[model samples]
Target: MLFVAGSTVLGGASARAAEQADETSTAESSPIIVTASPLPVRLDELAAPVLRLDREDIEASQASTLGALLADQPGLSESSFAAGASRPIIRGMDNNRVRVQENGIGAGGVSALSEDHGVPIDPLSATSVEVVRGPATLRYGSEAIGGVVNVLNDRIPSARPSGGYSVSGGTSFDTVDQGKEAHGALNVATGNIVWHADGFRRETSDYDTPQGEQFNSWTDTSGVSGGGSVLFGNGYAGANVVHYDSEYGIPAPEDPADPVHIDMRQTKVQLRGAFAFDSWLRGIDFAGGYGDYRHDEITQSGVVGSTFKNKEWEGRAEFQHGAVGPFAGAFGVQYRDRDLSAAGEGGELLAPNTTRAVAGFLYEEMSLTDALSLQMAGRVEHVKVEGTALDTATITEYDVSRDFTPLSASAGLVWNLDGGWVTSATFQAAQRAPEAPELFSKGPHEATETFEIGDASLNEETAYSAELSARREGRGYSFAASLFHVSFDDFIYKALTGETCDDDYASCTDAGGTGTELDQVRYAQQDARFYGFELEGKVALLRTDTATYGVTGQADYVRAKLDGGTNVPRIPPMRIGAGVYLEADRFMAKAGFLHAFRQNKLGPNETETGEYTDVSMAFRYTLPEQMTGGASVKISVVGQNLLDADIRNHVSFKKNDVLLPGRNFRLVASVDF
Candidate 1:
């Protein structure tokens, strides 16, 4: 049994899952689908490593931000830039290398351009989340070079509810930040039509750290979504619209006295449909979306200092067929267009730009035998970017346009052993085109306090990677492990230039002008290598019809360096954790602790972070059905950082100035009818 999405082993034993399996495994039941894939197969058939969080797991975490909710998972970390601006970091990769998506579509936002911008999608809207790494990333695009974080909300209903309608809602409160949230969702079905609607609101004051209150570190956000679907005998058509808004403050070390924050608004619309065929073509699925996003950085005087906006649209179609004997697969084609601009303070950080790309991908699998299978995938994309670049020789801005054709491919072997054990080995070669900001950014970015420089001549980045994974699942025990290595040619990175500047880049390169103000960094390329390993295991010591006891342990580590041995910036340190728990028919309780080692692998001009221990405890209870009129009611209390240790995220750029929230407790209540 497993309390995660998709496979029992690949999704790892999450923190709460470490307690006990809530339900028994069933071989006759339908397999959980991994929506990240255009044409997903069964769990044991996957050739790459993955981690997933189902609805139950998500409820227990109840984090305010998506990044914070997943930070404890194996092989995952967050930028921790601020209370509202954190983003997920996977396999020691962040920024443009990791893709953040929603419901099988790209979450069109500017969070990747800088660490201070927050991802517009909230976990409150997600029913589950998947973290996919390794060769499987080819299914998306080179943008997911490191990995992909796909948040599945299913706003559009494809099937009817058990009853004519179903309703669920809840409210939560926390002590650490004095935060409160309210959310509700409804689904209704009428004959062949299904409808869905959901909304949420959240607000929080400054949070308390181990030292004291963190000033200007608060968050306020809300969002609503409505959708419906029409189901036919052989297929279905659906559409959804979403609106999100948020405003949060940033704790800038240099301007601590002056409050700075971001005000954001985003609207997204999506349309999708599926059709089944009787000919050689099995079926076809198509989806498209449009998004308009904008965020304004406000200064102390309440004036909009810098405004960033992005308008984008994308569409893709996937066709499934078994044209080749003994082989089944899907082919997909995608097109995307994006326009972005910045205005007001430090507006020159990046001139107005537009990026367009078209791609075609193929995935095929063959069962060599009942116990062995082969999986192959390949993708080719053509990309073009328009922006402005600094003409170093001429010392002025110049119009620039660059084009690239990137190709990626992978091959893997999946083997099913005896006693429910599975293993996979994969090799991939991927190429990525430079993003707009990576090739055209100039002038200063106030959020990071850096004078940025980009090179239009930058070439495509390429990676050659290999991965080996194995897992075993049984009634009483489970184990999972993965090891991966990646070698990159011309890896793109920002290099510090040991110079300082003010509102502009002028005088930054002068010998006497260097100061403790904004630093100067230029995008550069170099050969690099990254390697990592993850391990998880759990054992059920006692089991009964109504009660079970278990113990769980997990460990993960990653190392990355430039060809000359220089450590990569903002890499998460290794962590080892273990826990114990008990489960009863109506009550459950669990406790866990994780210890992070001291991070001494310092990047250039960076300081090392101290080690710390994080401890958590939780208790849950469900009311008797007789007391709720056949409805389900649940209450839970969760305690985090029970150790009250002063913690700093080694993977954050603001780690030196900002400390993680201190000891805190949260209470939640929910009902399903």
Candidate 2:
């Protein structure tokens, strides 16, 4: 099955490649704007593969969350435990391996620690989004070793009164649930001060699955943001604050006898400010932010209550100047203080503690030529962890404190080859320290029911990666491809030893005993590597003054191997997707299909999941301009398990019963006033 699905995806990719080649033979030049840089540069001048999602694309997709929207991109996958909980997986790395940024600053808090937690930002209010793939993301930080997803919003007040408001309502056929959302913003300029304010609210009811109606898991979210800026001579300064809150849950099984239920709620607040200073020596940019996040969960049986809280503060300052001889660059120092604590209903601390990180970085981008550019960056960070641990047997407490200093660096070169083609290559060395839960937690994970044991002596994980990419943009057509290989030293993974405890409750701690425990699954410095390539392009087959038709397709393949003759776990197989789109003056339509090949090659702790295909279609219509109103209606139908194939995302952990939302349908209506 795996071989057959793989061949089908490859065949489809070949056909698309051929079509792209033909389109490029007689294409015209299309001007592509580049915003991946601090200053906007043309696409032809960039050496990296940056994927942009504009407002039009965002509206067309009509996804509820950023994670779901990114799932359409090549080389990206998402896993969700419920409608409100989803996380992105790039290449084969996720969690702490990936970074999610808001504007240009790190989205501080605890979203990176678990898969069930949802990102706080609302995508409906975003103006645009960009994904920096591969090692090129090293400029952000070592935490982005996998990649970077940056969400951009117009939180800054404009110099003129310019703003819009939107409201939407939708429902799903399977869940019989209703959803409503509203957002409003106003920006006005007066004298030297520009003021801006925005607010949004969303609410949804519990949804239904194939088995039965999932209950008690409704979502309610609300946020308000405001900012003010003042222009002083050649510099400007601004301050902004945003507060958000959400509550949701996951229902137990259909049978009332199951006796289990899970509920979660989160609240977040962020305050930030930036100041720009014009000086004779160099221009300086200073920014600082503070964030507070709290998560509370309630479970029906084994674990009555579980709660986690995280509070963080960060500050950074950078200076850049282009007049310096081949030395136009930015250097900044950053400090983050994080406090995390978790406990169960019995007052026993499951994971306790506080950690502090101080980091400094230097980044330089030099133009060797009009067609060639070089980038060099490095960061040094010191992390300190302090906590108290309880010894189960002795019933005694132990005080622990440890500090680690990790260093990371990267270099890259981009070249604009003649003939509308561009290429870039990058190499990076990165490291990640252990998270709080990984070092001090003990007991069963309420979500998975696995007994977790922490190792205080764990060391940092490190890796090196290299990537090469090329892109071509022509009239009515564009194409891009990237290849990457990453090698890891002391990669941390989780494994289950085929042993059971004497009472089947606690795992044996002695070396000679037979028991199962989830610890930093240990392994010597083993060599592991990941290689993948992605190709995506679009071509306009026919175009007229009032109408256009186009076809787009993308495919990605990834393979991972370990030196000890083992297959890497949790790696997604090859995937391919294609879509056809047609647009008129006021009407648009699109149909697309995505196929994921079966993955049967099992690692020591993995199992096989069958192949699956999903199909979706959408249509939209715009009202006439004379009415002084704009409204759109969209309907989408998705078919999962098109082949009625059974699949599972995880062998031991998640039995995700791949029911494919089973012929689900949704309709949404939006209006602007």
| Candidate number achieving the greatest lDDT relative to the actual structure | 1
Misplaced by over 4 Å in model 2 are 1-35, 56-64, 134-136, 156-159, 163-177, 206-218, 231-235, 251-282, 300-304, 345-349, 388-397, 498-527, 629-653, 657-660, 671-673
All candidates: CA RMSD in angstroms?
4.6, 8.0
lDDT score of residue 136 within candidate 1: 57
Candidate 1 stretches with Cα past 4 Å from truth are 1-31, 36-40, 510-516
Q: How displaced is residue 143 in candidate 1, in Å?
A: 0.6
lDDT of 1: 0.80
TM-score of each: 0.94, 0.83
Candidate 2's residue-wise lDDT over 263-340, tens digit each? 333333333333333443344555567777666665445455566677777676655445467765566677778777
User: What lDDT does the true structure give each of the candidates?
Assistant: 0.80, 0.58
Clash pairs, candidate 1, are none
Q: Superpose all Cα atoms of candidate 1 onto the true structure and report the RMSD in Å to 1 decimal.
A: 4.6
Model 1 TM = 0.94
How far is 492's C-alpha from truth in model 2 (Å)?
Answer: 1.8
Q: What TM-score does prediction 2 earn?
A: 0.83
